[model samples]
Target: MNMSTKPENKFSEYLGNDEQGNMRLRLGTKFAAIYVEKGKDIYKETSKGLVKVTLEELVSKPWIRENFERERAFQRSKALAVGLQSSHIPLRERRAYKKRMGWVGAH
Candidate 1:
């Protein structure tokens, strides 16, 4: 008997494009991977299956919580950098602000 087999693609379904237009795929049955133009692709797993989810829903998984925390910290740091770069802020005051924010020597 000749058995015909089909190749299985792990990223089986093209769910849709994210807001940035990067393609999102369903990885197997339980997870989704979003391809980004820059940096690493983001992977999210959900028990809700193929249903579309918001950013909060995607990052709410316990296994990926650390990634969410890291993202939050990065956003905070970016905001601090922008605030410290204001022309009106003196270098001395910026240094004081950094120290008060516990960011001394963190750069």
Candidate 2:
């Protein structure tokens, strides 16, 4: 897409600085707000309360750090793949497509 047609990216929007200079990121609606302590430890605020995230897990590309932001983007035709999949897809249609594609059945 052209620069003029490109939508804004909110991935960094969630990254904010607290008065104490802590890093904060608000994940999806299902997930809780994530906070970084001294840029070393990561914490997630959940219904069960604050939970610590291991550095190993956080450093993993497919988890909270990279994957979280990549998977949450909604822009120019990208939303069709990321944001609207659940709402746009009907179970019956999905099953039919899967059956036609010879996938056997839903997992």
Candidate 3:
């Protein structure tokens, strides 16, 4: 397989709790969502109720996985901005400061 055509294995990164300790993903709109409880069990919201699902099944849908990944990235950026602001780091030095503090990939 060509490296350019190979899919990246980022499933684990998107399947965990956020900084806020919430293990949930909003599916497209707020009307639907997915929740993961302890032990990695997954559930999805439906017109009827929550339905159990497998991690492999969930991530197989490209759109669903893409949306989840996008959400996770947004959350991480928001958290990083908050952390830098709370630390009183200047905007100009945020890049250098994050690198120096070893937080660039600490996540």
Candidate 4:
């Protein structure tokens, strides 16, 4: 990419937990409302329905956070490896990609 030239893509993304493991938070996209799981509750009932904790928290108790981290790291690398040009992906595609990438969307 060019150092001075701005990317045709409107925004970039990443995966990470907040200080309290909230959400990555975005703007003007489906993920704009995305959120990360937080708390020890394996499941919770929301207005939509019951939500289950991710595998990371589920296995973290018995084993180590390292296992989950490795899996997540691998997933991140896989997504990046696709080498999909963010700008070429188009807006609708980006929205759909994000929606598929996370489960935080309101049903």
Highest lDDT scorer? 3
Worst 10 residues of 4 by lDDT: 25-34
Q: What TM-score, over all chains together, does every model reach?
A: 0.34, 0.36, 0.45, 0.24
For each of the candidates, the C-alpha root-mean-square deviation to the true structure, in angstroms, is 13.1, 14.5, 9.9, 18.0
The residue-level lDDT of candidate 3 at 50 comes to 67
Q: Candidate 2: which stretches are off by over 4 Å?
A: 1-15, 29-32, 47-49, 59-63, 67-107
Better structure of 1 and 2 per TM-score: 2
Better of 1 and 4 by lDDT: 1
Mark the regions of model 1 whose C-alpha exceeds 4 Å error after superposition.
1-32, 35-63, 94-107
Q: Considering every candidate listed, which one attains the maximal TM-score?
A: 3
lDDT of 1 by residue, 3-85 (tens): 43432533244455568654444444334453222124354444544334446754664334343445446656987889868
Model 2 residue 101 CA deviation (Å) reads 64
* Candidate 1 vs 2: which has more lDDT: 2
In candidate 4, what are the lDDT values of residues 1-107, reduced to their tens digit?
64433333423233455586543322223323222334533343346755665787557643223334454577678777676554477768778877888853735
Overall lDDT per candidate, in order of appearance: 0.51, 0.57, 0.60, 0.47
- The TM-score ranking, best first, is 3, 2, 1, 4
Q: How large an RMSD does model 2 have?
A: 14.5
Candidate 3: regions farther than 4 A off: 1-22, 28-41, 46-50, 54-60, 93-107
